[model samples]
Structure formats: structure tokens, C-alpha cells
Target chain A: MVAPVAVVGALFIVYPLVKLTMDAFTQGDGGFSNFAAVFESAAIRNSLVNTIVMSLVVTVLCVVMGASISWSIARARSAAFKALLWAALLLPFWMGVVVKAYAWSIIFAKNGILNSVLDQAGVIDEPMTLLYTRLAVVVGMTYTMLPYAVLAMNPTMSRFEPEFLNSARSLGSSRTAAMVRVWLPIVAPGLIAAAAIVFAISIGFYVTPVLLGGAETPFMATMIGDDIFAFFNYPRAAASSVLLLVLALVVLGTALKAVGSKALKGGIAG
Target chain B: MTHPPRKLLAAAACALALTASACGSDTDSGSGSDGSVKLTIASWGDPFTSATREHLVKPFTEETGYEVDIVDAPGKFVANLEAQTQANNVEWDLLDSTSGPDAYIAHDRGLIATMPDDVKERLLEELPEDAVTDFGISWSVLGYVGACNAEAVDTCPTDTAGLFDTEEFPGSRTSISTSPLVNLSMAEIANGVTIDELPTHEIDLDRAFETLTEFQDASGAWWSSGDQNLQVFESGEAELGISYSGRAYGLIDSGTPVEVIWQDGLYNPGFWNVTEGSDNPDEAWEFVEWIASHPENAAAWAEALGYSVPNPESFDFIDEKTAKTLADFPENREKLGLMNYAWYVENYEEVNKRWQEFLRG
Candidate 1:
């Protein structure tokens, strides 16, 4: 049983990674020409830059949005409020990412739900082109990443003691002050975790970005996919995949370090 | 140490499961040995696939006594081909694709084997030098024509220039959504410059941007899927839009009041290529010859799939209305432009750079 499991693991995960890495370094007609081309091309660089920018924007948005939403759920005074929060958070999780992106697209399209509603309500004069813009991509990515953040923060948020806020309030600390100084510090690690997840997912996302973004807004993962499948250049695609893994690792390392620093400050880690 | 090793083992097992799942899909098997060659032919998505199988494959099987196995190539054609090629595994025998950079890449990689000798000879005799390539033949011509909801726009824009003239035709429009190919070409044409006369070495990047800006201002949204185009026409999402003629037929079939104008449409042939070093070359070649030859087969293919066939004679096989609707008719055929695919292949890196820069702004 153990041997079979080990063999399966090695064949799938280990072999592919090893094969991909070997392929990336290979140079020839069917080889590193793609990687060389990727490096030489300005489009790839622009896409990489766009991907990073979009990922950062989404991570920031998720942190702020996730923290606020989770805080309300955490501080809910009634069962109904908690139920509502859970319903909202879990509802998105049940829906497919592609389905959600399509829903957002329909709402954001020129003759989409938003424009139609707006038109009926007399809010705007005409429809706006919201489907194939960076703004649309950001919205889509943020929506996809929202549940991860919410789920991550939920447990930590619920664990947060109301007595800490009460103590701060008793000491004449305003509600905002208590949240900023007391509550934020305790939830900071979870917030960092949520941000990291959102950032990592955003950097490598394809579906939402491809559907919602313009040609210029190609993410690194999508570019790698294009190289392997669209371009039929495996060596280059492999190289790009390796690069993506590296980028992801660097991001994860930075996030870990940040979390470690917070843990040390809070005396959670020695 | 025990706990860490257990966790590592678990992680490793999960990774293996994913890899196994990916590899399980790529397997090559011929039809049961009854002297009937079972060839797996792959194309893009549905209605087209179903139509082609219905109209062409079924009739071919009925006549030839060879079983036709039609499959939708996973994801896009190039990616599916790449994965198979990368593993040195050839599950797909015949593939339907246009002469794009990947075809060139595949040819370079020695992934495409020889076509049937007679098919090659026929192509050389019939197709112009620009039509055929070493790797694949011109299967069907892809074009971007001005299709309109007949109810909204009384006159479909006749040419590429008139497409951007929003004031004259006041309604939403869509072009080939993702690929910047048509967009760049149209921009040059709209800018009063022909692509043939433009500097071969250096593409005017500024003109591309200027063209897209005009399109973005005038158009509703960039369409990404065939379904999106179907919805656009069906729901009257756009008054006039550029789409694959095949997709437009789907709308018309569903009783959408949409019509096409093939004037100045970019037409390129979709090609069929066999995987190099396949164990079943004879079987594959047999399937290819059956598909490419026989106007009836091609006509049934076009009728079933809603896509236009390269066989000029196939038009006669379909109904009069359907025949007129084909992208390669005399009224439309003359205006159907061909891009120097070889030029695009060689300078893809440069073209992509300019395309990205243009899109960013």
C-alpha cells in the first residue's frame, strides 16, 4: 500500500516538476526558444508587471474588505447576524469561479445588469464599458479571493475575546481606537494569512483575468499556459512555470517572515 | 520527525493524485480491429463539433466503413497538442487548426508528420503557394465579417472601415475578441493603409493603438467566447458585431435576426495535421484523405458544424440559403483577405509586443 502510494506520488508530482525543470534549461527548436522569446518580448514583461500590480491591488482590497466583513460577523450580537454572514460567505464558495466571473461580467457589461438597473433607476445616462478593463479584472479577482480571506479570518475572528474591547473601552478608548490598537493587533496574523492567500492566487490566476482583462493584462500563469498550449513551446512554457513557482515561493517567504515578525511581537513565538 | 515525515508523505500523495489525473487523459487507442480504422479527430468546442460529426463524419463512416471518433481537444488546440507532444504521447490522430504560430512551432518540433501524398499533390495543384504550409493544409477559412441584428441595423457595414463608423451605424459592435489580429489589421485599413503596403519589418505600433481606441469608443465590449457572441446576437447585446461565421450560423439557426457581411473579411484556412511518429500513420492518413477529399463529406461537415469548408465545391452541396451564408462565396470570397501567416509566425514576438503596448493604453 505504502509503496504504491509513494510510486504514484513520485510519478505525478515529482516526475513532472523534474521533467519541467529539465525541459526549461534545454535549448533548441523545440526548446528554450520560448523562454528566450518570453524574456526578449515586451508583452511578457508588461503582463508580468500587470499581474503583480493586479495581485497587489487585490490583496490590499481583500485584506481591508475581508477584515471588515469578518469583524462584523465576529462582533455579531445575534444568531441571525452570524447566520447572515455565514450565508453570504459560504454562498460564493458553493458557486464555481468561472460561473461567478460570468455573473460579474454580465453585471458589468455595457448592457449588463448594472447598466440596466441604473438606467431603470435613472442613475446614469448610458452604459459603461466595464467588462474588459483592468477595473473589471480587479473586481473579478477580488470576488474570487474574498471567500478565502473570509474563511481564514473567521476562526481567528471568532476566537477574538470581546473582553479585550471592553477593557479598552473602560480605559476611555474610543471604539475606533480600540479596534485599531487592540483588536487589529490580535487579528493581524490572520489578516496577513488572508492577504498572502489572495496575493498568491491573484498572481497565478487565469480564468477571471482572461475573461475580464484586456490582452495587455495577461497574468504570468496565463502567459505560461499560452506558451505551453497556444504557442506549443514546452521548454519556454516550462521555464515560465518554473519562474511562476519561484515568484510564488518568494511571495510565500515574504509573507511567512511578516507573520513570524508579528508572532514574535505578540509573544506567540519565541 | 515522524509527524513531519507523515505530513510530507501526505502532501506528496496529493501532488501525485493531481499528476495522475492529468496523465490519465492522454492515451492512444485505435478502433476495434475489424479492418475499420478508428481515427480520433479533434476540434474546438460544440455545436460546431456536433454539427461536423453529424453532417460529415456520420456520412463518411457510412460510406467508408471506417469508424470516425470525434473528440473536442482539451482546452484550446495548441495547449492540448503541446501536452501530448511534451510527453511524447500522441492520442489525437488528426487535429483541426488554422496555420498559426503553434503549427509552425509544431512543424519545427517535428510533431507534424507527412500528409497523404495525393492530398499534398492536390493542395499543391489547387491551393496557391500562400494557402498551404509544410505542416498542414487549408481546412477552412476563418473570417471576421460585419454581422448585424437585422432589426437594429438595416444595412450591415460592407467593409472594415465602415465598421468603425459608429455615427452612420448607431449600435453596439464586437470584433474578434481576444486575438489582436483583426484589430491591428482593421486599424491599418481604417487608417487608410493596406497591410500589404505597410513596412514588412516594422509594424506601425501607433496606428494599432489609434485603431483600438476608436473601436473601444464605438464597440460595446470585447467578446471572449462563442456563447458570448451567440448571446450578443440572440439578446440583441450588440447591433453589429464581428464573429466567426460558424457562430453566426448558430444564432441564425436559433432564429436570431442576425445577418453577415463578408466584405473585407479576413479569411484563413483551418488545417488538419497528424501527430508525428504516431503508431497508426496509415490509419491517420486514411482518415485525413477521407476528410479533405470528397466535396460531399466537406459539405456535410460544414452543414453539421456551421463552419465554412475550404472545398469551394462544398457550397453546391448545402442549401441555397446556407450556401449564400458560406464565408467563401463569390460575393464574399473576393473581399475575404488572407494574412501572411508566415510573416505573423516569424514576427510573433514583435507583433505581440506592439499588441500588448497598444492594449495597455
Candidate 2:
């Protein structure tokens, strides 16, 4: 059984990865020249930086929002309410990313609902510039990835023991102190897992950023896509992909180590 | 519980059945079984597809008794054609390509078939001189013009220079960031080079880049797609932009206060080419010939979609007011610059790299 799975994994996953790695190296003089090209090019460098910055920002926002929602759902008295909350959170994930991005574009357009509403309410004399900006891109990405973050934290939040908080309260600790000292530590692993997942997904976002962002917002995935489709520079695209993969792995590894492997597994499983 | 495993098994079985059925459907829909010849034409999104289907395809089918299937092939036209060629199973009978590097590449790679002699002769006689090529026939021409919001700008600047003239047209502007072909050409035209002189002489790249940099300085955003360009104007993000004439016309039609500056418009023609391995080559040629020969159909298509057909005679069928908005209006045509497709084809890689660098700045 293990052999069958191993064979399938090697054939399906490892083979393609190996091929990509080989292409990245062998395309230009069969060495690390492709990687050098990627680093030296200002466009690629900017895209990489943008990707990291956007992913980090999105990850942070998702973690905070997800944790808040998860805490509420877990602490709710009515099970029906918790189910409804889960349904609401899971709704966006069911829609296609492109569809979601397009929907956001409509909402974020200058004459769109948001501006129309604001203008009607006398918020301002002029319409706000909402579409084709970095803010719009972040909003779209966060909306799409928020569900994942929430779901990741759900199991751990639901399994949280109220007794720990009660015990800390009995010892004359303030509510804030109890949350910071006791409750936070218990949920740290779940938070870490959520952040890691969101970051990993955020870094690879292609459609949302492209649809929502203007010239200032060139993500690494978009650059890679351009290299492959527009420029037909497969080697450079592969090199960029490898670089992004490495960065993602580094971030994930660091998070896993900080959270501890056992705790993360328990958090996810629970 | 044991119930969980049972549910999982049932879901797995359902997924397997769905996958098998999807595969079955693919094979079933691959080809026509009836005796009547069917041809598949790869097309871009609406209103181009809808226009073509309504005015060209339906009429052709009615007249010739051949079934035509319009397949959505936007940015992936070349890739799809290449895949079909590689797989030795060409599904698409005809492809809609721009009469530029794309046609050259297709011709060079033997992906497109040479036009039948009669079809070529008729197309050469009917269409513009540049539109008739060995591999493709020009279907329509879309102009890249300076579009301005009438409500925002007090006096609309009429030339390409006005796009960069911030003080005269003091509002946000945008241009196509993905491709520099139109912008660079327009920049050359802006720097005192006439449309006729552009193809014969080498364009001054340094001067063009300098002018573009000035324009970029004044611009608030850059659009990558036709929809984005329309949105920029429709949403008031941009008061002025270098837009495809069709999109500007769309805004105008939808009651937006937009005006298209015909001066210094860059007219780029899209071509219809029969695929190399087309099973219905004769039928494909007939369809292309019929569409090309019928000026009324071409006019109807042009009227429906805000682009011009290459057949100048089609103007006879088009209304006078709508005809003036098209690229081929004699007065506007004189001012419009034809895209130097050869130059772009030769220097695409270098230009694209430089363009990316420019955008980074």
C-alpha cells in the first residue's frame, strides 16, 4: 500500500517538480544563471518584494480576523448560531477565485455600490478612487483567503477548555491578563497554522491581484505568468517559481518550529 | 463511526462516476457526426464573438448550408493552435489572429494553411492592401485612439500629444501597460513623424521612451485589458486614456460623456486564418470568402461592434454618422497610423523587456 502511494506521488508530484527544477537550471547554460537573472532583473525583484509584502499583510489581517471570528463561534451559546456562522464564512470559498475577484472589481469601482452609497449618504462631494489600487487588491485577497484562515482555527477554537480561563480568573487575574497569559498561549498553535496556510496561499495568488491591482501592484505569480505566457521565458519563470517555493517553505518551517510539530498537528486535528 | 467511512465510499464512487461521465462527454462533443460539414472558428470574447456569430456565421450558415461553431479563444489562440498541431488533432478549423507577428509566426511554423487562390484574389480586391496576406484575411480593424471624458475635460485635446499634455487636459490618464506597440508608435507620431513615414523610417526609440516617461509621470494608472480601459473611463478613475476605439464607442453608446480623438489613431487589423490541419478546409475557405465578399454583413458587424471591417465598400452599407466614427473614414483614415507589425514582430522580445523595465520605474 505504501509502495503504491509512493509510486503515485513520485509520478504525479515529484516528477513534475524535478522537471521544473531541471528546466530552471538547464535553460540558460545549465547552471545557476537563471536564478542570477531573476535577482538581477528589477521587475522580477520588485514583484518578489511586492509578493512578500502583500502576503505578509494579508496573512496578518487574516489571522486577526479569523481568530476573532473563531473565538466568537467557539464561545457562542447556541449551536445553531455557530453552524450559521460557519456557513457564512464558508460561502466565499465555494465561489471561483476569478468570479470573486470580478465581483470585488464591481464593488470597488469608482461608480460602484460603495461609492454610490457613500455619495448618497453625503460622505463626500466626489466619488472615492477605490478600484485598481493596492487597497483593492488587499481587500480582494483577504476576502478570498479569510475563509481558509477561519476554518483552520475553527477546530482548535472549538476544542478550547473554558476551565483554564476560569482557573486563571480564580487566581485573581484580570480578564485581559487571563486572555494574554493563558488563552493566547493555548491558541498560538492554531494562529500559527492559519497564518502559515494563508501566507502560502497568498503568495501564489494570481487572478485577484491582477484583476484588482494597477501598475503599482505586480505580484510574483503575475510576473512568473508573464514570463511564461508573454515572454515565453520558461527558465526564468521556473526560477521565480522555485524562489517563491523556497520562501514559502522557509516561512512555513519557521512557523511550524515556533508552534512545535506536535501542537500544530493536535490543533489541526482537534 | 462506521457511517463516516460508508459516506466517504459513496462520495468517492460519485466522484468517479462524474469524472468518467465528463470524459465521455468530451469525446462525444469532439466532432460532428452528421454528413453536413461543420467548421470551428476560434474567436475572442463579446461583443466580437456575438457580432461575428450574428452577422457573419449565421448568414454564412444560412447561405452555404455549413454549420459553424464559434469557440472562445481569447489570449490562448496561439497556445491552443500549437497544442492542436502538436497533438496532431486540430480541432479548430479557423483562427482569428492579428495581422502582425502572430500571423508571421503561424505562417513560419506552418500552423496556417495558404489561402485558396480564388479566395485570395477576392480578399485582395475587396479588403485593404495590408489586410490581404497569404496566411490570413483581415476581418476587422480596431483603432487605438486618445479617448477623453467630455464631462471632465473642458476642451478635449485632439492629438496624441494631448495625452501627455497635463496642463491642457488636466486630469488622470491611462495607457496599455502590457504592450508598448501602440504607445511607442503613437509617441513617434506625437514627435512630428507622420503615419506614412513611420513604417519606412526607423522609429527613434530613445525619443519615444522619453515622451512615454513624460506621459507616465502624468498618468495615475495603466490598464492591461480592454475591460479595464473601459472601467477606468466609466468609473472616472481616468479622465483621459489611450483606448481601443471600440471600447470608447461602448462608453459613448452607454451614455457616457466620452469622445474618441480620431487624430493619430493606431489602426490594427485582426485577421481570419484557416488552421493548417483543418478537416474542413474547403468549407472554411468558402466561409471566409463569403464573409469577406459581403459588404453588408461586414457593415452590420462593424455597426454592432465598434470596429471597422477592412472592406471600404462596406461604408456604402453603413450609416453616415456611424461611418465617421470608424477608423476607415477618409478624413480620419488619413490621420490614423497603421501599426508597423513587421517592426513589432522583429523587436518584440527586446521591446517587451524594455517595456517591463519602464513599468517598473
Candidate 3:
């Protein structure tokens, strides 16, 4: 049984990855020129920077917002309320990514609901520029990845002992102090897991940024797509893909190591 | 322990089956035992395929007892054709393409079949010489025109130059970012050059980008898709934009208070070409011939699509008011400029790199 599973894995996953790496090295007159070209191209460089920046921003936002929601849901007394919260959190995941991106575009449009509401409320004389900005890209990405963060952190938050917070409070800790000194440390493993997953997913975001963002919001995945479909430069696309994979793996591995596997496993198991 | 060995055997058998399936080809021989012919035509998908099936395919199948299958062929047309040809298992009998350097490239690579002499003569007589190549025949034309929300602006842009003149007509503007052809061409026009001079005048990238940067600063969005263009206007993101005439017309028809300027418009035509090594070349030729001969069919198609057929006879079938909005209308045709596809194909890689840099900047 192990032999068959290994054979399948080798044929599909390992073979493609090896072929891609070889193609990246050998295509376009061979050598590491493809990697060189990736670094040299200003467009690709900008996309690289943008991808890293956007992913980091999105990960931070998802953690903050997702942790708050998860904590609230976990502490809620009503099962009905908890169920509703879970449904709301998982709703976006149920929808297609492209559809969600387009929906965000509508909501963020100049005359969209947000602007229209703001305008009617006398909040501003002119419509705010909501769509086609880095802010919009981050917002869309966070919305899409928030569910994963919530799902990751919810289990841990539910299993969290209120005694820790009470004990911190008994030791002369304020609410904020209790949260920072006790609750946060106790939930640190889940937070790290959530951040790792969000960052990994956000780094490869293609549709959200494109549909909701402006020209300045081009991400690494979009560049890879353009390289393959528009430019038909497979070698460059492969090189970029490999770089993206390495970046994601490094970040995820570092986060997992920092959190400690025992803590992570405990958090998940709980 | 016994279960492990059985599972391993099952897995191995499954892997072998998957490998065998992957190596198999999806080839369909044209001839049936009952002597009927079946041909597969690659399409760009609905509603083009849907319209073609309803108007063209159904009629052809009824008139001639041949089964024609319309399959979705979305991206990298030439690459797919080459791969199939190399494998000696060509699946498609015909391919619908935009009449441009791509069709010529396919012809050069011997991926598309050459038109018979009589068919070629008919297409030449109907369409402009440039529109009908030996390997392809122009079916319909779509125009890129200046579009504006009429309700928002008192004075509409009469030509492409007015789109860049923000001082006179102030408000947000948008254009496509994926292809540089329309934007660069319009920029050239805005810089006091006519479409006629574009063939000889080397495209000045610096000048184009300078103007484009100014426009981008003044514009609210840079759309990448047709749906986005419509959204830009409908949602009031941009007061003015350059978009396909069909999209602009759709907006007008939907009561968006938008107008499409036909003057100095850029036009791109669609083509119908038979693929090389088709199992039913004779039936494919017959289908192409039927499409060319029936202008009414093309007109119905163009009307449904909000575009124009290359066959001028199509006008007789469509209403007069609708005909006036078409790309190939006599009045609009005079003001229209055809994109230099040959130049684009030759310089696309370099031009696109610069275009990407400009877009990023």
C-alpha cells in the first residue's frame, strides 16, 4: 500500500516539480539566466516587492480581525450565536474566489454601497476612492483569507482556559494586561499557525488583486500568469513559480518552527 | 498485513490505468459506419459559440446531413494546434480566430489549411484584400471607440484625441491595460498623427507613455476586461473611456446614457479558418463556403453580438438604424483605422515589455 501511494506521489507531484525546475534551468538557452532575468526585470522586481508587502499586510489584518471574532464566538454563551458566527466566517470560503473578488469590486465601486451610504450620511462631499488601491487589495485578500485564520484559531480559542486570564487578573493585571500577558501567549501558537497559512495563501493571490487593485497592485502570481499566457515565456514563469514556492515554504517552516510543533499540535488537537 | 498487500496491488493497478488514459489520444475519425461525416470546430465559447450554433451550425447541419461539433478552445490557439499536429492526432476540423498576425503565423507554420482558389476569389470580392488571407476569411469586425457617459459630460469626445485632452473635457478616463495596440494607437492619434501615417511612422513609445501617464493620472481606472469597462461606466468610476463599440452600445441599449464615438475608431476583425490535417476538410470547406455565401446569417450573428460582418450584403438583412452603429457601416468605415497586426506580431515581445513597465510605473 505504501509502495503504490509513493509511486503515485512520485509520478504526479515529484515528477512535475523536478520537470519544472529542470525547465527553469534549461529553457531560454540554458544556465541560470532565467533567474537572472527575473531579478533584472523591474516589473517582476516590483511585483515581488508588492507580493511580499501585500501578503504581510493581509496576514496581520487577518490575524487581528480573525482572532477577535474567534475569541468572541468561543466565549459566546448561545450555541445559536456561535453557529451564526461560523456560518458568516465560512460563507466567503464557500463562494468562488473570482466571484468574491468581483463582489468586492461592486462593493468598492465609486457609487457602490459603501460610498453611497457614506455619501448619504453626509460623511463626505465627494466619493472616496475605495477600489483599485493597495488598501482595496489588502481588504479583499483579508476577507478571502479571514476564514482560514478564524478556522485555525477558533479551535484553540475554544479550548483556552479562562482560569489563566482570571489568574493573571488576580496577580494585579488589567484586562488589557491579562490579554497581552496570558491570553496572547496561550494563543500564540494558533496565531502563528493562522499567520503562516494566511501569508502562504495571500502570497499566491491572483484574482483578488487583479480585479480589485490597480496597475500598481500587480502580484507575483499575476506576473507568472502573464509570463505563461500573455508572453508565452515558460522558462521565466517556471523560475518565478519556483521562487514563490521557496518563499512560501521558508516562511511557513520558520513560523512552524518558531511556534514549536508540540504547541501547534496541541492547539490543533484541542 | 494482508490488507496492505492488497491495497498496494490496487494502487499499482490504478496508477497503470491513469498512465494508460493519459497516453491515449481523443481522436475521432470523421466517417461513421452509416456514411455520415462529423467535424469538430474549435470556438471561443458562448455567446459566440451559442450564437454560431443557433444561426450557422444548426442551419448548415440541416441543409447538409453532416454533424458539426462546436468545442470550446479558449487560449493559445496556435500552440494547441501545433501540439495536436505534432502528435498526428488533430482533433479540430476548423478554428475561429481574430484576423491578425496570429492567423498569418498559423499559415506560415502550415497549421491552417489554404483556401481553395474559388473560395479565395469569393472572399476577396466580398471583403477588403487585407481582411481575407489565403488561410483565413474575415467574418466580422469589432471597433475600439471613444466611450463616454453622456449624462456626466456635457460635451462628448468627438475623436480619440479628445480622450487625452483633459483640460477641455475634464473627468476620470479609462482604457485597456493588457494590450498596447489600442492605447498606443490612440496616443499616436492624440499627438497629431493620423491612423494612415501609423504604418510608416515608427511608434514613439516615449511620446505614447508620456501621454498615457497623463491620462492615467486623470483616469479613475484601467480596465482589463469588457465587463470591467461596462462596470466603469455604469458605476460612474470614469466619465470617459476607450472601449469596444459593442460594449459601449450595450451600455447605451441598457439606458446608461452612454455614447460610442465612431470617428477615427480602431477596428479588429474575426476570422474563420480550417485547421490543417482535418479528418473532414471537404465538410469544413463546405461550412466556410456556406458562411461566406449567407450574409443574412452573418448579419444575425453580428446583430446578436453587437458587431459587424465583413460581408456588406449583411446590411440588407439588419435594420438601417442598427446598421449605422456597425463597424463596417459605410460612414463609420470611412473614419475607421485598421490596426497594423503585422507590426504588432513582429514587435509584440519588446512592445509588451515596455508596456508592462509603463503600466507598473
Q: Provide backbone clash counts, one per model.
A: 5, 0, 0
Residue-level lDDT tens digits of model 3 in A10-81 = 998799899898989898867889999889789999999999998999999999998899888877777677
Ranking by lDDT: 3, 2, 1
Overall lDDT per candidate, in order of appearance:
0.68, 0.79, 0.80
Candidate 2 has a TM-score of 0.86
DockQ measured for candidate 1: 0.26
Q: Give a tens-digit lDDT track for model 1, residues A62-175.
A: 889987887787777776766667667656655666798888877886667888898899998966667777999999888877866766555566678889999999999999
Using Cα atoms, each model's DockQ against the true complex is 0.26, 0.33, 0.23
Candidate 2 has which clashing residue pairs, if any? none
lDDT of 2 by residue, B9-49 (tens): 35434543564454331121244787678888888868778
Model 2: docking quality category? acceptable
Model 2: residues with Cα > 4 Å off, grouped in runs: A1-22, A26-31, A111-128, A249-270, B1-38, B58-68, B83-91, B97-101, B104-119, B276-286
Using all chains and alpha carbons, the TM-scores for the candidates as numbered come to: 0.80, 0.86, 0.89
